[model samples]
Target: MKACISRWASEPFRVFFPLGMLAAIAGVMMWPLLYTGKLGFYPGEAHSRVMIEGFMGAFVIGFLGTAFPRLTGNASWSCGELVWMILLWATTVASALNGQVLVADTVFATLLLLLSSGMIGRWACGNRDTPPPGFVMALAGILGGALAAGLLAWNQKYPLGFTSYQFAKLWLNQGFLLLPLMGIAPYLLPRFFGMESGHSFHDSPTPPPGWWPRFTASVICALLIAAGFALEAFGWSLVGHVLRATVILAWFASETPVFRRGKLSCTPGNVARFAVVALILGTAAAGLWPLARVGSLHLFFAAGLGLAVLAVATRVVLGHGGRHDLLVGRIVWLRIAAGLLVLAAATRMTSDFVPAVRVSHHIYAAWIWAAGGSVWLIFVSRYLGRGEEEPS
Candidate 1:
């Protein structure tokens, strides 16, 4: 038991990926329970909090905790740090489950602080390499999350006005997740498509000349996205959404081959493309049709960020488990899971637009999302503990 725990600690994803999926399942199940009268209170805020802070938060921490050390040539997370993170994360989920939104957000803020402090320490001392230029967005993301979490906690105590509340939500949901995804994609996604990433981590103390241009562009995009959020908070919803979508599209066009042919032929690549499209479409739809903001954002949440997380997690698991052969070919389970997520997103949107079947479709969408998460977990859990030296 001691040895097993130690081994799992060596790679944070081994523990947190599974935890993330479970949180996702728990989050979606809230709706069903509420409709069936099993739950006493409305689950709107709790559900969103759990899905975003608990589900997505777990994956972010797991990925960064594992990858950050490698990117900077620093030591992996200490056992103490891992223990504290898990405790805090688990507490956040539990508090959210009990509808203690303030408590959950406060704990989540602490977790982000801990994570950021470790990464900053690595960057400031005893690091042999610099992370890619795009990681500036990642830094922005964590700081944004911490700020949003703090605001949310404060709002629970002393109600924030409508604009302030919406601003916090925007920061927590879109800004926190989207920034990191866009930042990391340029550095990581190429590897999934069997192409060399130009921003791959190296042991150089200083970045190459070519790195600065991309770095400046990423910083600019990140700022624009934040400004867009501010615009939305100030009631310029349409302008904000359009600006965000345009910036996202332009950034991807410049940094990735997302719009190009031949690169996204593989299952993971296709899913990656779908994720980006969902994000752009969702952002635009929320602006063009403000009445359907709830449904439109699901495309960004359930399909965009959710599927991207699964695709990247799958690659990480397979690669680290010595199953590189499976990374390219049509992995039937992953394809099915991705299809289900798309279906869920559509079903959820339909619930918002078609009032006749709103309740039923909302429940159906939740179940579909849960089903997709289960499928992913069932397949990927197989690779979690396998030694990297093991044969495929």
Candidate 2:
């Protein structure tokens, strides 16, 4: 079994992480989608988040495990990669479909899959890119993230308490996002098309806060998220607010500049660029976090952060896969899933969101989440089956 994982380190792991994140997102959208107000068969929103996050971790670990090495032209996974991917995905899907992520299920979910995936990912993220620091940063971030995930899972020996929720949120926010952004964004930012960063716009060797500051903030953010979950769940709303404020401030301060620094913008001509408005809306929402009512924070996160992810992923797939496809015939999606996400976010924010007299909310959420995922999957399937890597 050890030898098996060692051998097949690269591809399956890489593919799984993003796929898992997609699952978590889907589960969230599925619940609360009933016009009839009947909860979907998916886990309630809270459990759904962690369960899906587990799925995301599964893929990320898999990807980082091998891709890290591959970036430096070092090598690929040793073995057992497929087994890990299948088991994890199967369990996650089962958990999600069940509608309740119990302690036992969470334990099982971590045991047979998430934990193992992290270990493998850590093994793969051994090398660093030579000419640039992007690969190195990504490698380090992924390894750190994997370690964090393992620790979070390990800490889950108890019931689904507040601490576990914080850990779960950290896994998504920090392990899944912060680390990857710290590591890969620099690389992906430039070589977006899987090609050279031709104009030399974002050309850089070191990343933000001179590495140390970035690391400090990332670690702090993780801790704060964990603390916030614990405090909030325990009814310590004041502490939770304080922790969230700190984390959010750090997150924005650290991250917002990266986008601003570069002259390179998301191609306005690129249909993907439409996500910018969504991001702006999200940023605005975040800026107003304390004031907003119930679903506002979610709107910003989904529209700004999550929606941007959809646009970016779809664009990346098209560009990398050599497609360059655009919107769903004509309308916008969550950032864009089905055109429904736009409406969904609006509805979430306003509740009275337009006269959606009949259609269920979950359908819109599912379509939005599934849309980009489906497109990405289609591209991957085609890419894997057809021929060579995307042309350089």
Candidate 3:
């Protein structure tokens, strides 16, 4: 038992990713009841908090915990560090389930703080090799997560106007999360497609030759988006999003050959490429028509963030285990789940235009989303831990 636990601790994703997926399914499953007042608590708040901080947040932690040390060429996490995080995360999930918002938020904030500190400490204590630009962006995301957590805790404790929490939420999802997603995509996608050139998980890619300019621009665009939030300038933020989207679109186009070279069909990476396109269109639509902001944004969440997380999680679990064949061969249900997610996004967006059917559409969308999440929990849950790597 001790040996197994220690091994599991080494690959944090083994513990967190499946937990995140289950949380995602449960959150969506319950949304309709909450929205319709069949349940007493605030469904929107609880659901959003769980899906963002719990579901997606878990993957972020697992991936970063597993990858950060490697990126910095530092020592892997100590046993104590992994155990502590596991306890804290488990407590957070329990707290959220029991409607202990204050407890959940507080615990989550502490977790983010600890994670950020650990990442920074690793960089500070490691060898003198210059870290990649992606590492820096990841750190920025961790900082943003910390700020978002603090805002949530404050709002729960002091009852400040919603703006602070709202801004924090926006910062967490749009600015912070986007940075790492964009930064890591350049590295992760080629591996997903099994490209002959570029980086593979086994062989870390050389940092892009023109790293500084690209990193700086990404930072500037992210900052502008945050500034728009601070000033409540939706249009300005949309401009930043558009610029970001354009860059991502270009990157996708440039990498088409690499994608084409891969043997996998409907692999997570390929699905995520479509997700990126959805994100671009969603941002554009939200910017163009203020009335459709909420609806339009779901396109990014469901298709972009939602599918992207699944893809990355699938790739990480399979790739690290040296079972890349499963991704293309037996994972047909994964493709179906991805399609359902796109449908869910479309259904939810259409609801905004059809007010008469909005309530029904929302429920339908929720069910579709839940079903999509359920597919992963049923199929991939066992594999998450099977790939745990021994400490280097």
Give the number of the best model, judged by TM-score.
1
> After best superposition, candidate 1 residue 8: deviation in angstroms?
2.9
Off by over 4 Å in 1: none
Per-residue error (Å), model 3, residue 384:
2.5
Q: Candidate 3 at residue 318, lDDT?
A: 78
Error of 3 at 39 (Å): 1.7
lDDT (CA) for every model shown? 0.88, 0.45, 0.72
What TM-score goes with each of the models?
A: 0.97, 0.60, 0.85
Candidate 2 segments exceeding 4 Å error: 1-9, 13-42, 45-51, 58-66, 103-179, 190-294, 315-342, 352-392
Number of the top candidate by lDDT? 1
Query: How do the residues 116-164 of candidate 3 rate in per-residue lDDT, one tens digit apiece?
Result: 8988887777743445554556677778877887777778758756566
Relative to the true structure, candidate 3 reaches a TM of 0.85
Error of 1 at 168 (Å): 1.7
lDDT of 1 by residue, 234-273 (tens): 9999999999999999988777767776443677878888
RMSD of each: 1.3, 7.0, 3.9
lDDT of 2 by residue, 125-185 (tens): 5423332333333444444444444554455564355555555544444344434443444
True-vs-predicted CA distance for residue 223, candidate 1, Å? 0.4
For residue 136, model 3's alpha carbon misses the true position, in angstroms, by 1.7
* Ranking 2 against 3 by lDDT, winner: 3
Model 3 is weakest, by summed lDDT over 10 consecutive residues, at: 197-206
